[model samples]
Target chain A: MEFIFVLDILGVVAFSISGVLAAMRKGLDVFGILIIAFATSVGGGTLRDVLIDTDVSWLTNMTYVYVIIITTIFGIILRNKLNYLRKSLFLFDTLGIGLYTVVGVEKAISAGLPPVICVAFGTMSACFGGVIRDILCNDIPVIFHQEIYATACILGGFSYFALAYFNLPQDLIFIISGLIVIAIRISAVVFKISLPKVY
Target chain B: MEFIFVLDILGVVAFSISGVLAAMRKGLDVFGILIIAFATSVGGGTLRDVLIDTDVSWLTNMTYVYVIIITTIFGIILRNKLNYLRKSLFLFDTLGIGLYTVVGVEKAISAGLPPVICVAFGTMSACFGGVIRDILCNDIPVIFHQEIYATACILGGFSYFALAYFNLPQDLIFIISGLIVIAIRISAVVFKISLPKVY
Candidate 1:
């Protein structure tokens, strides 16, 4: 439980960083940056809670909101000193995707959802934040155009449940699943991998 | 039940018109207009349903999708002739808010939710589409900054339940509530009225 909490915080911070970078790149004001950061940090969990008929996660936990604010401030203050915001932002985004996907799967399983729905929720939780961020920034979401984003989350979710069925330790399962998502996302970005356009 | 079916179609067309106008102002291509129109027409209802643990309204009704596409095509073909796009867009937007607020309230009431939550759902259904549209267009949501936007929906919802509780005739209640919403919205825009900023 404690380990999960730590990972959740890390995920939130990573998402916030990515969101701030996206907003800053668009030259949005402080309010806009804060809004994007908050949305990316908690958007996935909020969507999951709403779908599962629960109170919103961030509303119930003010700590998440505070974390987003602090992280946004940090990013704004250090942006001038940072030499490569793009690369760092990409790394943080990948980390966020992996962490949120696993946490989403865990939450869905706890709610007694079917495996397929759990995987769907995991992918949605991992990617929908970036979708909103891109939309708000007036850009096409990179996930829709550039890489195998949601597919990585789906793959990780399948691996997670498969390992669970094999009686793997829970922590090990989470670590392995998260690593798979991160690896797939990084490889996809580096190798110019993407889904074919239906049209 | 038949009345609801008819009203649902009307509401879809009304929302789609506003969406098309907004997208046209941006000079979007056909695909972009379709996406924007679809989001504007159904985004609020989708959010409301997801929050209430119901399936998204459009995913079950292909007619809504058709209506949006048809509206987008119509808007594109007649763009140059539609000098009154701004006026017509406002009218359609107001009508949509009136109809959707009542529908949202009715759905929540049918689900046996408390009155306050029903009111909230009504306002949410009436406003979230514009919120999404603005986010996607890289503008601050009009509701967050301008006119008596969400206030009109809330008032209309109150009028609806108030009349129903007093055993008013069904048609009279619906018409009166909807007219109230339209009146408030139109008046606010014409008079350049807005809620005072809190900050």
Candidate 2:
């Protein structure tokens, strides 16, 4: 339970940083940066909650919002030292994808959805914010244009269910599933792994 | 029915023109222009359909996609020559809001949603695409940032229901309701009408 909480915070921070980086790249105003950060951190989860008729997670917990705002201010204040920030942002984003995919799948399962739908929802919860950020920045979503993004989350989700079916310990299942996603994403970046473009 | 079909087609063309002009202003490539045009034309309705769990209207009608593509290509080819595109784009956007507000309201009412929800659904259907467009451009959504954008759609929707209650001629009610939205939007733009900014 405590580990879940920690992972949730990491996920929020990761998403917020990614949003901030995208906003900085666009040279948006401070307010715009905050707005984008907030949206990126909460948008996917909010959409998921709304779709499933659940209370909005961020709205119910002020800590998530506070963390994002604090991180945004910190990122802005340290804007000149961006290289380190970029690396951290990528790591955090990948971790968030794993954590969020787990939570989203669990939430859907609790809501009585089928396994396939749960996996789809899980992947959506992990990746839709980045898609929204890219769309808002007038760029094709990285997931659609580049190496495995949602694909990693989706595969991780399926792996999680498979592991659970085999009676793997819950903690080990989570750790292994998350590591798989991170490994896939990192290797994709390192080796330029990408799907064949249809068009 | 024929009149309704014509109005729907006109709305698509008008919205597509508005999207093309917006993309041209951004100096996007042909692919971007086509994407923006299609999104602008169908985005709101698609959102409405998704939210209501109905079949996506435009997917069933490939003509919508074809129309947007043709319009986008035309806009790109005539980019340098279309000095009056700005004025024309505004006109079409206004018409789009008017036509779509009615379409959305009718659909919602037919679906047995309460009146207030119907109004919200109608306004959302009219404005979501432009909001999406602004977001994609890495700008605050114009609907959220300034002007009486969604307000005009709401007012037009109210007029529609009111006219229906008064047993007005169905066809005349359509024209009157749509004209009201156009007038409101035009006035808002010309007079800089907007809600008070939140602090």
Kindly list the per-residue Cα lDDT of model 2 for residues A43-147, writing each as its tens digit: 878767766667888777899989999989987888788676677768878888888888888887887766766776687789878767777666755565467
Interface CA root-mean-square deviation for model 1: 7.3
Clash total of candidate 1: 0
**The candidate that achieves the highest DockQ relative to the unseen native structure:** 1
**Residue lDDT tens for model 1, B1-199:** 7765666666666677666666656554444455567778888888888867786655434677777878777877776666666665566667778888888888888889998889899888888987887666567787888889899889888988889899999888888887888799889889999999996
Off by over 4 Å in 2: B1-46, B49-107, B110-199
| lDDT, model 2, position A191 | 90
lDDT of each: 0.78, 0.78
For model 1 the local lDDT of residue A22 reads 86
What local lDDT does model 2 show for residue A46? Answer: 77
* Model 2 / residue A64 / CA error / Å: 0.9
**Candidate 2 per-residue C-alpha lDDT over B1-199 given as tens digits, one digit per residue, 9 for 90 to 100:** 8776766777787777767767656655444455567777887887887787665665335677667777767766776756666776677678878989988988898889998888888998999988766655556777787889899999999999899999999888888988899999999999988989878
Docking quality (DockQ) for each candidate: 0.10, 0.07
Give every prediction's interface RMSD. Answer: 7.3, 8.3
Question: How high is the lDDT of residue A15 in model 2?
Answer: 84
